[model samples]
Target: MEATLSLTDKSGVADVRRRAIHMAQALGLSEKLQADAALIVTEAATNIIKYAGQGEITLKSFLEGASQGLEIIALDRGPGITNLASARTDGYSTGGSLGAGLGTIARHSALFDIYSVPGNGTALLARIADSRDGALNGFQIGAKSTPKPGQAVCGDAWGVRQIGTHLWIALLDGLGHGPLAAEAANRAVSIFLLAELSDKPADVLRRVHQGIKTTRGAVMAVALFDTDKRMMSFAGVGNIVGIVSSGSETEHLISTDGTVGYNMRTVRPSDVAWSKGSVFIATTDGLSTRWNLNRHPGLTDRHPSLIANVLYRDFARDADDATIIVVKAT
Candidate 1:
């Protein structure tokens, strides 16, 4: 389940603390774990107010088989992290106190990753696993691109995992915009990373559907590229788009039906074929359906970051969260 909290003042800290405690109670987190999560959330929220002026936070739970945990995201469009190395130091602070924000967050959570730029904003992600049996899986992430002026991200998320000889790529677009949308998108990536490798795309999507039941559901698409068989299998729900490109042609992957998390009964899985000289791109609805496979030729030849940038620049509408995930076979 997922819950979103806005942190604009001191009370926002309390609100987040209370929500964390309640979620911990409901999830049966040990007392120590609950308290640790609460303290970390408070520090994160306080940093948002002190550094960003105002911000939003999201808390989500991920449960698969016997493994379970919580993921927290703190986001703001305020001044970005000035000196990441200094900020992460134990005694460095822009506000003149002990500079333990990043350190404390890292110490308390099982995993932490931060993304920031001087003029842009900052995104802080933390995940706490319930048991030691769980292992973390990193996404087959490509490169990061520069966002054009006047462009805002639409909270599209994607990850790649290599299981045996097969590689899995998944994309998700969180509902709505801004911080809540970012939270949902981030949580989907965390879920995909922590999920068992053996789970099928349909089962994995179903788990994500059930995981986010408390918050706004998202549109999801998952694909598996099998090197041995030279085929690509995919499954999707909602409006997230997936495209497969070859040397001279491109093919679009279709969603089974329904969105992730809610109205899940109508959702199913769809599979396709794959081969070399092929690239896959998954994007949110912010992309105008006006541009099809024919117009965007040889896009996969560029870097994945470039692929996303070109699409965002050419077709993205400023109305909602826009995200694109690109995977290329080498």
Candidate 2:
């Protein structure tokens, strides 16, 4: 159901391409679809080499009854994309070889989303559905922020939106540390507060990206919790991390692209349907991924603010700012 791959060197690219082809064949995807997937993966891996210098890829497959599909995530902490619109354009490239990397990926997958920021990082996620039954309209979500030890917290941001019985939340971690990040995060929250009242998660993020262009950009994750469908939908950029906890199982999600601001273009986001008994958590990279989830089992059940505080207490590197948001469905 879950598999991880890393592309740290030249050889890794070939390996990723071969493995992706193998997985596509095993899933019984059409020959055309399988080949398309392989090409996109290859292109993405090449982009990682050309841009990030190094990166990792994760592939997660989900099946419900006879339906099956795949979610591919590419992550890197490189120089980040400075002009997303130009990058996604037909012939835009910093390396000067027909800049159609993102555009090609968008054309190949059923769904594609990219998030990035200057001086931060980048995250790219794509989903390919093998059958109509495999398509899920549920939700996927994530959130991140920065919490200082003793600041007035002028820039904290959070929001909750409801559609029928479905509810969604978004938290942000702005650029830089201290008040600057807080201001960015707060502005993001403010945007969510206003837009969530009657907008989709993608639209909400678009507005946030546009709103923060004047200020320093921020890292953001938006989550939609569908009670009727019993699923959670998410999309994120920059350093935000999202995790799902079900009973004793925990699944952590790292961003696929970069942050918002300066150079980011409008990004298409990804979605994941949540199973029952799942808890969602999102945070800034200020909290280390190396933190032990086993030792802190109580994390899934805590309040968002408290969860942020606990992560700050237990794993914050202190060299950077930290923040977290926790959501659990009963």
The clash count for each model shown is 3, 24
Q: What is the TM-score of each candidate against the true structure?
A: 0.54, 0.50
| Per-residue lDDT value at 28 in model 1 | 80
Backbone clashes counted, model 2: 24
Compared with the true structure, model 1 gives a TM-score of 0.54
Off by over 4 Å in 2: 1-146, 149-156, 196-198, 265-268, 297-309
Scored by lDDT, the top model is 1
Per-residue error at 280 for model 2, in Å? 0.3
lDDT of 2 by residue, 1-330 (tens): 445577777788888878777887777778887777777777777788878888877666645324566667776778778888877876566764335568877777766777655665566766666553432234333333434545545344666665556777887777766678777887888888787455666677788888988888887888777777666667777667777777777666645466676655555565555665466777666778676555544445533323443444457775566666666554
Residue-level lDDT for 33 in candidate 1: 83
